[model samples]
Target chain A: MNQSMVKVFDIQKDDFISAGEASSSVKKILKQLGVSPEVIKRAVISMYEAEMNAVIHGGGGKGYAEFFKEHIEIIIEDNGPGIENIELAMQEGYSTAPGNIREMGFGAGMGLPNIKKHSDQLEIKSEVGKGTTLKITINF
Target chain B: MEEFINSVTLDKDKCKGCTNCIKTCPTEAIRVRNGKAYIIKERCIDCGECIRVCPHHAKKAVADKLEMIGNYQKAIALPAPSFYGQFPSEYSRKKLLIALKNIGFDGVFEVAAGAELVSAETEKRLQTENFKKPMISSACPAVVRLIQMRFPGLIDNILKLESPMQISAVMARKLFSEKFGISENELGIFFISPCAAKVTAVKSPIGIKKSAVNGVIPISEIYGLVHESLKNTEDDNQTNIFSSDIGVGWAGSGGESNALSSGKTLAVDGIQNIIKVFEQIENDKIENVVFIEALSCPEGCLGGPLAVENRYVAKSRLKQHMEEAKSEKAQIKPVLSKAITWSEPIFPSSVLKLDDDVMIALGKIEQIEKIEKDLPGLDCGACGAPNCKALAEDIVRGIAKETDCVFKLRERVRQLASEMIELESELPHTMNRTEKNEN
Candidate 1:
């Protein structure tokens, strides 16, 4: 048996119906790993928030989860226009999601900050007009 | 250790092994092998979805026979409120209760009365108890088991309280033993449940070491006796009925949520719908909700698989009856708060895990992924597994063979036939078709 497991999910752009698929799969794997409920909840919250970020703002992307003995790590990379101001984007209620997405009950500007809140450690790398890479780690 | 107890059973003689029940089960607990379908005891939640879907009427719910009541010196019937919806609206709740007394029971207890106590207790807890947000209701035993199996993380969110049935059973024994001058054990406490889950809950309870309930009888099973006994009751001579009772409303969907004053409360019913909500709650997508009432049966208890009436008809009937009774105030009183609280807490079930060791489970997960990729992905259920993924897991678990899948079996047969043809072509020149053609 390997000490760790890796799973990947491909997020389609604006696929609201399947928005939670990545987080859900990760949650199931965590449950199978006998991860504590609190840890699973935190990981799921951050995972969903980050996944939604890719869907709504990043124009779909790829998310990866690596389950380890001590902690679980999630990495999401998107090709959408990246954030020019990382500091401002980290603030609560600061979202660049379109008006249409906000009207649909999403893009409340809580995505990035909420993910940062639930994750034990969060790091984001972005370049204007290129893409964004987000990494989140939730301790078991 | 808690004994494995399940009320749902299969009548082998009637089962056609047609793979019908396996597909409808929310837990995917049923499997066909050797031309017979059997439920995996640990995975079954007794939701009775199989019983509702079996075309051959092979699935049956095991409940105590009415004749079992005669075994005790005195027996008190605790009828679920859904039972009231089974009778005509003309018959007042009191009249229906008295009819149970006529059916050889020494006394009758209304589960709704106990429900009122639970409602009061929940309101108090909502204000005082420090709990995770979106406390899920435990009124439905099927939902309790569902959380235990599939949503193990949410076990802490379950409201820590005895159900109306258990509370009514405890109260019934106290009230009846004092009235009959008998010991509690001497008095049989039987719950008239609308579903099979309650029967299992009594036999193997969670959040309690043992259930106060002595036995459970389904409403569908007891309806005949109560109906026959109803002719002897005089409805006009009965005491005043409270049509406006908050507890009585617990029979249908949203009843539990409606009875409380909790802010941002939500009620969800039906097995699949509740499963989805549970996933969302786990993901924290459903935030700001203080409580959630999830019922496994559609339309709540009124739509239980063991229920006698159509849920739609029963829903209307229940509404009209409650409306008529609304003219009266309140006769049911809340019991002591401590009396209705759960004796223990529920623990998450690990039955759904691929293995006990995380490393081993991870290895199995990898294998399952590889196998699933190769599977036909048709989810045809011809392999006796619920889906392609399930069959892959079963194969990894060593409980099933890969050839169990018809597609895989066909591929293997085709490969073997090609190999045989090639072997024949390689036969000695004297025996080979190619040698004959050259000659």
Candidate 2:
């Protein structure tokens, strides 16, 4: 399929105030693009979950969204501490977030699971001492 | 194609081309074009937020006049529950019902009675049917239309029940005709509405083929006449009683949900707040909520633009009136009637389409985004549109130009200045010498 547009946003770590801003912008763009509501909803949900994961876990991250004729691809990469146990991190309700972050009503550990549930294709890559990268694709 | 008729209209003479209405419009249906606020008919839900916020009183709710009732041999007034809240608590409900008779109505039927019936019917449906979790209320026509225009995916969640106004009109016309030995055509059933949306519902029903109500009279228009009649009545002999406290409570927010003694219910008032709840619903975040009563007007019907009293005051009066009711139980029982249910499927109004083709729409979106980047993002509405984003959309649609943006125009002027200087510097040596000599 032909690539229509590519949008990128640099997300700041622990910036709760602007955490969902990038995802919301992508959703607005998709809506204006006349993507089906169902597709937009799934893409928005997956993008939002991944964005939040980057903000809460990965130190600071950058989000990139590519729109194509048949699908939308979202890639989020962060320089924060990488996950040691990918299997446990993907489990629902399993969180490594500190108590302070948990007190803020997030970190219920459903982020990666929700992203996987909403996305047609989800890929996660991480290094112990390096950063984590997540790629989510939602097909129209 | 049938011409679309909207109950809310802009009075050009009264309009100051202010952005107040456009900003307050939940659906973004109003646009200030050519120094006049114009309502886009297809996009409008007739929520009356524009009418409520318009400083110049330019927005008006158009409904049938009192004189229209004179055409029929007999007329019955189907007074909405909000109609009672217009008066003080000191006035008896009976006196108010009698006032309708004094105002030339041959008979009076309480819409609250229909509310009670609808409430009971909805409860039964909730229990019997294995339908979707959160069954949305179809009472507010504006909310229904909002779902159609914006939340089309949640269309199946809306309950297929006729509004109390429609059911009352149907029952009122039937009973009035039978009692007076007159044909149904000779008897007019008029709804005393609290909002402009109800007027539109009567004129152009959403799911139904035809509206049972012959006309709609806004509460504000007849408040003075009703007050006069209430003062003139010396005896209570002509008073007729109808509707219980449960029925009367339907005037305020959460009234319908309160009446439904079923599963968990969520009642949200105000267009913006309702939209937020609808978003949550659309996201599947709310799973246990059995029913949702969403009202476009703040504090429900009491806060309708056409309502005479303050919303809080009206709510208090309505509560007091409900407390004073003689019967705690519903006076009218629910009946199994076909007229109380929707006759046809409610289709979504796809007003959000940017273009017919996906590729073309995506192209337009790219153009809009490019235009948006050049805008100031102030959302000042100075460009005769709602905001910078809307201006960008208008530009993409060919309704506006890039130079139409004030900031963009300033930028152009600055660029032009730099370009002129560059052109001056690039001039040929002879031409430069001649220009220097002229200077």
Candidate 3:
């Protein structure tokens, strides 16, 4: 079978209305590429949630997703306030976001946890003053 | 499965082509293109928010027509427990059953009976430590799909129980087929539905792939038929269709909780209410709140858009009916062994793919970084996406380009200030020459 895949995205922060836009587009590309629904859904959920974090908490960031024959990879990086404690942040319901964010329907602290749950491999690196970067890979 | 079960339909005539739905949809499910609105099947949660807000009434929930039931020799009406709230207090369960029969149903089965079974199964499952914390209710198929799309991580938490309608349909069909020697095709079970999600559930069921029920009859159409019949059969109480407790009290929000078991469970009516509970659950604040019952419809199923009476009125009437025909004891009988065996498991079909390898994904991130450096941070959806990062993801997906975003492009232009200056210095001295000639 011929394997054809090419897709890219750039994520920006504070875009509430279009927070999941890139994820949806990636989902569309995966569908067109005929990726299995299971793999596509996981990648979309993980990537989308990450993208939301970048927007809501990352101050602003960029997300790049790639579709390959054996897997899907997503990288999100931002210059926003970086994580102070990676381990504590990974815990569910440990959000530092202000209450206003909660009103907008986010900051339940499920972002990183959900990312870990859906992805085959996940990694996060951050500098408190510099920014945070998240990388997720899903194997088909 | 009916191939074209079209659970949701848009009235092209009424659609004004507004992108309101496209913008508001949590899943980006609706796409406005070619001057009309279309639901991208893979993305829609069928929350019925569209159905609720459409100014033109363009969005309609596609359900079974009453006339179609004629195809079956024997048809059973499996009314949702929410249906109890649709009539007045004076209305009798016997009359309601008679009304269904009067409208041509061979028999009527209370879905609350099915709910009773599900409540028991859920209670048993909740006692296990292995069960995912804060298990989600499967009764609302829309909620199930929402998790599948947006919160796949929480998918494990979704209760594996078959919906009440599915169970009742299975039982009702088995009983009818075995006793009367009727062919499965001749026995039709129709769910009097409250929402579009139920219609979709019947079409592409979750835990159980194929639905036992054949068709869905919207509650709105059946309400008038039942109402008119009740007035006609005012004096005659001959039809003992719904066995008291099985029929009445099923409509109100907490009725199911009350019927299932009074203690150690919680029932939340309406999507907003459920969302609040979910937030609490996420905080790990709601403990011992086992077997949370969530109804997408406010006031429980009684508030279904297709239901006959106002939700408040229906709720009151339902309470009165339950009081009038109170069941002395809650039936905890084991579900019939033949009730749908857990056979087919619904697995999510994967669709996400990485556009490149790990290194390539890294490379794209670098490019995204460069692009982010040059773009404005405003996440205004004016660029057609929800925000700048979403726009970046769109770039990676090839669905959109960085240039598609006006703010990004403007920032890019601003960032090239040095080049702009160099170009200005080298620009044809046309302006200078023109000025000299004028002087």
Top DockQ prediction, candidate number:
1
What candidate 2 gets wrong by more than 4 Å, as runs, is: A10-17, A97-105, B234-240, B326-339, B410-439
Over B108-191, each residue of candidate 2 has an lDDT whose tens digit, in order, gives: 888888887788888887896667669999999999999887877678888888888888787777777988999999998989
lDDT, candidate 1, B1-439, per-residue tens: 4678899999999999988899989988988999899899988999988988899999999988888898999987888888888988887778888887778787777788778778877887788658766788899999999998888878888998898888878877886798789888999998888989999989988888789898888888878988998888876443333225576889999888888986689999999999999998888778678889998889999999889999989988888767765666655343334446677877877777787777787888899889999999999988998899989988998999899999999999999999999987576755667657877
When sorted by lDDT, best at the front, the candidate numbers are 1, 2, 3
Number of colliding residue pairs in each model: 1, 1, 38
lDDT of each candidate versus the true structure? 0.86, 0.84, 0.70
- Look at candidate 1 and give me any clashing residue pairs: B243-B325
Cα error, residue B191 of model 2, in Å, equals 0.8
Ordered from best to worst TM-score, the candidate numbers read 1, 2, 3
Model 3, range B200-291, lDDT digits (tens) per residue? Answer: 88887777768988998899978888778777765344333332453345466666556545376788876656665754453334657666
- Runs of candidate 3 with Cα error greater than 4 angstroms are A1-140, B1-6, B178-181, B234-252, B258-266, B272-286, B328-341, B349-439
lDDT of 1: 0.86
For residue B385, what is the lDDT in candidate 2? 82
Cα misplacement distance, residue B3 of candidate 1 (Å): 2.2
Q: iRMS of every model, one decimal?
A: 1.5, 3.2, 10.2
> What is each candidate's DockQ, to 2 decimals?
0.70, 0.37, 0.06
